[model samples]
Target chain A: MTGYLVAIATLVGIRALLALGLNVQWGFTGLVNLGVVAFFGVGAYTAGLLAVAGVALPAAWAAAIVASALAGALLATVALRLREDYLAIVTLGFGEVLRLFLLNEAWLTRGANGITGIPRPLRSWFPAHYDLFYLGLVLGCVALIYLALERLRRSPFGRALRAIREDETVATVAGKNIVRFKVQAFVIGAAVAGLAGILFGHYLAYIEPNMFVPQETLFVWLALILGGSGNNRGAILGAVVLLGLLEGSRFAKDVIPFLTGVRLAAAQQMLVGLLLVVLMIKRPEGLLPERAP
Target chain B: MAEPLLAVRDVVKRFGGVEALAGCSLDVAAGSITGLIGPNGAGKTTLFNVVSGLTAPEAGRIALGGARIDGRPGHAIARLGLARTFQIPRPLARMTVLENLLVYAPDQAGERLRGLVSRPKTIARQEASIRARANEILRFMELAPLASDPAGTLSGGQKKLLELARALMGDPRIILLDEPGAGVNPTLMRSLVARIRELHARGVTFLLIEHDMDLVTELCDPVIVLAEGRRLVEGPFAEVRRDPRVLEAYLGVPA
Candidate 1:
């Protein structure tokens, strides 16, 4: 039970990191990125493939960050000319295309069989103390990212992003390089998502194309919005609450034997959907509204 | 005997079937508060748009300080020492009044991503100066009391003042104000006018677009009038008010 609890905490930490990435893009800069999972998948695949090929974990991690950021920059340049809703559609399509590519590319990604036996760092040093060690490591990463984002939130750079989010024309007249800033923001968020992906892939010791579906991106968005879009702590809080609700539903199956498998899964999803609707109707700004700078 | 600080030459802008700016040209002399006036559809704002790089012209050349800026982006034009304010006053609504001003400070070290982390001392020093400068500007505009308030919470006139203060933060050599007096109250309007006069006296050039003829007459010398997307008359407000063409443009017949 203790091991299981630690594993759940680790999952929550990973989700928190994902939520933070979305918070930076959708919350801070108001860039509606629907292809967040695509960046995550790129990072996971890049790191996984490199690790499989005898590359060191540190080197693979760095490469994964670069690859995902490049992907984000490419997407921004190609689709950012289309504003708002149109941009959302383009990004959504990009995620679908990326997942399909990964699914079909048997030679590189092993098709749907998925990559297994992915190495975990420091797993051998503390064999009995593995889960706690990993939990501590993941929490440390989260702390670093949280601190960095908090610093950025209070900086002049963050103010400019909010300024751009409010009115691009006004930001332009005030001498902000809108395109440059937008691309930079997209890349930064993508890099963070990539780091989260690396952590998730190593922890799972396996990664499949199916793991990065649009539904996964939707969950991250839900977490960020539920916590509070612009507030970093809200992003983390939303992830914890969301994960608790999701994992807590496992007991529903034990309590009611009839609610099993697909039925139980469908019920959980419906609950989440209903929660989103209620939140949108009552507290659209989320539980912790964005703080004014 | 001196070159105009800003010049727009024969700019043409068409929207589908309607021409908003057709062969419009004007020049603003350095250190002068030039007024721009026109009827509802005389293309005053359109010309400002073309000059400020908000809207690309079909045919025209816009120059600021002898350098062509029409084809450049809005921020590029701003960096070249040209700044503008929207008639509707689009403040960074979520930010505090001080943040709104600080956000527009050109080329701040902290604005760079690396600079934010790499040079903390330099960023802190720069931020201190910006905060000090913002507070001074707030006091000068009589907005000191509301400096900590969200810009969205300010009254309409205060928003206008904040908008002007934002442009001033850019330290632009030339400013294009689109109807600064339109929605402001009388007392606020008087203070706004005084602020403009003070800025003008300090050698900041202004090209103002206004429907308030009273303001034009009082503060403007060398007022430029646009009628049907073309320069109709250009002279002192006193002389332009008497021109048959100007009167015909405004009143639909010679006065």
Candidate 2:
């Protein structure tokens, strides 16, 4: 039971980190980035490949973050000028393209077979309580990220982003380089998402193109909106609750023997969909709405 | 006199088949409140857009403080001490009145990432001064009581006042006011006029677009008239008001 709880907690921590990144893009900066999975895949593949090549964990993590940040900067440079709907389409296309590249690049990503035996740092050191240690590490990182993001949201840089989000023309006339700030937000958010991917790849100990789907991006968005859009703390909490709903439904099959795994999975998805629809209709600002700066 | 602070020369802008700005030219004298007036579709806002770098004119130059600024971006022009307010008053709506004011404070050291984390004391000191200045501006605009209120909650006239207050935060040398008195109540309009007069007295130049003839006649020194995207006349408001061309521009001649 403790091991199962720890696994759920670890997944929640990872999702929280990803949702925080999306919050910075969609909530604070008003950038509609629908290609978060692209950055996630970049981080996971780069770090996992480096690990397979015998690189140290810290260096692999650093390289992965840089790769994802560069990818984000490139995307922003090309598509930040496109307004909301067009940007969404462009980013959605980017995620699929990156996944296709990962799937086709057998030389690096090992194609459909994927990369296995991706070592987790200190896994041998804590064999008896590995899940607990991993959960602690993931939660620790989530807390640190939360603090850093809160400080950023209260700082002038964050204020400038919010200004651009609320009124680009006003921000421009007030001497804010809207494009520069948008790119900055995108890079930072992507870097954070990359960090999450590094943790996620190690936690799974294997990665493939199938794991980094557009559906993963949708899950993070659902968590962010369910929790609250602008509040970082809300983002973290949202992840825990939404993931609880997802993983908890699996246990329902155990209690009711008549329900098969496939039937339960479909039922769980429908419930989550219904919840999202209700949330959008009733509280579009989210559970924790963005506060006045 | 002293090289007009803002000079727009023969600026032309077209949208598809329609020419929005047809070779419009005008000069705003330094340290004076100049008025720009025109009938609807006369390209008054388009001229503002051209001068402010929101729209690039297809033909001609805009020089601010005697340096060509036509092709630059809006933020670049803003950094060169030119600021403008929108006709609809775009405030950072989710922010408080004070935060809205502080966002426009020019070149804060705290705005940079490294400066925010590494130079904590310096950022705090700079932020303190910016807060002080923003509060001071709020007080000047009679909005001190609403400093903590979200900007979007303010009434339309109050939003306009907040807009004007925010423009002052950037230490701009010249401010372009778009329809400042258009939707304001009489008492607030008087206060707006008084504030403009006070700022002008302190050597802040203004170029205002106003439809209120009373405001143009009472506050403007020289008025520039645009009729069908062309300059109709230029002189004191009273003289231009008497011009037959200006009269025909506003009230079309009987067919």
Candidate 3:
């Protein structure tokens, strides 16, 4: 039971990191990045490939971050010219294209077989309680990221992003380089997502293109909207609640017995949809609305 | 005279088949409050948009301080010491009045991500000084009481004041104010006029697009009138207002 709880907590921490990244892009900057999973997959694949090639874990993680940041910058440079809805469509398409690339490039990504035996950091030190140690590491990362993001939220950089989000024309006339700020925000968010991916891929000791479907992006969005879009604490809370809803539904099969695995997955999605509907009606600002500073 | 602060020569901008700005040319002398008055669709706002880099002109030359700025982006034009306000005030609604002003402070080290990390001390000091200046501007604009309140909570006139205050924060060499008197109550209008005069006295140049003839006559020096996307006449408000062409443009009567 302890191990199960620790695993759930670890997953929650990982998801929280992703949600935080999304919050920076969507919440603070008002960028509609529907291809979040592209950066996630990039990070996972980069780290996984590097690890499999016998690179140091830190170096591999760093490479993953740089790779994802560059990918984000490239996408923003190309697609930010298209505003709002077009941007959403383009990013969504970008994610699918990256996923297809990963699937077809068997030479690099090992095709559909995926990478396995990705080494965990400090595994030798906590062989007996490796899960607990990993949980500690994940939580540490979450805390660090949360604090950093909060500092950013209160900084001039964050203020400019919020201004751009509210009114781009106003921000532009006030001397903000709209494209520059947007690209920087994207790069930072993608780098954070990449870090989360490195942790996740290493935690599972395996990663595949299948792990980063468009549905995964939806889950992070749900978590962000559930917790509160702009509030960092709300983002973390949303991830915890979202993971709870998903993982708790596993026990529903035992209670209802008629729910098979496929049906159970369907039920979980419906549960999310229903909860979102209720959330939208009850507290559209989210579970923890952004507080005015 | 001594090289105008802003010079637009024969700029042309088209929207679909319609020409919004057809060979419009004007000059704003340094340290002067220049008024641009025109009838509906006379392209006063469009001309402002083109000069401020919000819209690109197909044919024209624009120079700010004698440097060509016709094709530059809006933010780049802004950074080159030009700032503008929208016709309908576009305040950063979700932010506080103070924050709205703070966001307009140019060249803050804290505005960069790397500066936040590499020069924490410099960022902190710069932020403190910027905050102090923003507060001073807010007080000058009589918005000190609403400093912490969201800009969206303000009345229409207050938003206008906030908009002007935000533009002032950038300390631009010249400001393009789009209809400063529109939608403002008379009491607020008097205060707004007073502020503009005070700033003008401080050597800040202004090119205002206004429908309020009284405000223009009281505040403007050399007024430029537009008729059908081209300059109708240019002179003092007394002379421009009396021009047969200006009357024809405003009343749609043959000059």
Pick the DockQ winner.
Answer: 3
Tell me the tens digit of each residue's lDDT in model 3 across A1-293: 99999999999999999999999999899999898898888888899899989999889989999999999998888888766566678789989998888888999998788899998888888869899999999999999999999999999999999999999888888889999999899888999898888889999998878888999899999999999998999999999999998999999998997899999999999999999999999999899998765
- Rank by lDDT, highest first: 3, 2, 1
**TM-score of each model, paired residue for residue:** 0.97, 0.98, 0.98
The alpha-carbon lDDT assigned to residue B54 of candidate 2 equals 83
lDDT of 2 at B86: 87
Per-residue lDDT for B50 in model 2? 80
1 against 3, candidate with superior lDDT? 3
Question: Which candidate should be chosen as best, given lDDT against the real structure?
Answer: 3
Q: Write the per-residue lDDT of candidate 3 for residues B10-82, one digit (tens) a residue.
A: 9999999999888988899999999999999999899888888887899989999999999999988998999
Q: What is candidate 3's TM-score against the reference?
A: 0.98
Q: What TM value does model 2 have?
A: 0.98
Candidate 2, CAPRI quality class derived from DockQ = high
Model 1: how far is A144 from its true place, Å? 0.6
Candidate 2 segments whose C-alpha is farther than 4 A from its true place: A81-84, A256-258
Candidate 2, residues B1-255, lDDT tens digits: the string is 579999888888998888888888889999989999989999988888888888788998889989999989999999999988989888788889999998998897777877888998988898999999999999999999999999989999999999899999988999999999989999999999999999999999999999999999889988999988888899999899888888888889822
Q: What is candidate 2's lDDT per residue for A43-94, written digit by digit as tens? A: 9889999998999999999999999999999888888776646667888999
lDDT of each: 0.89, 0.90, 0.91
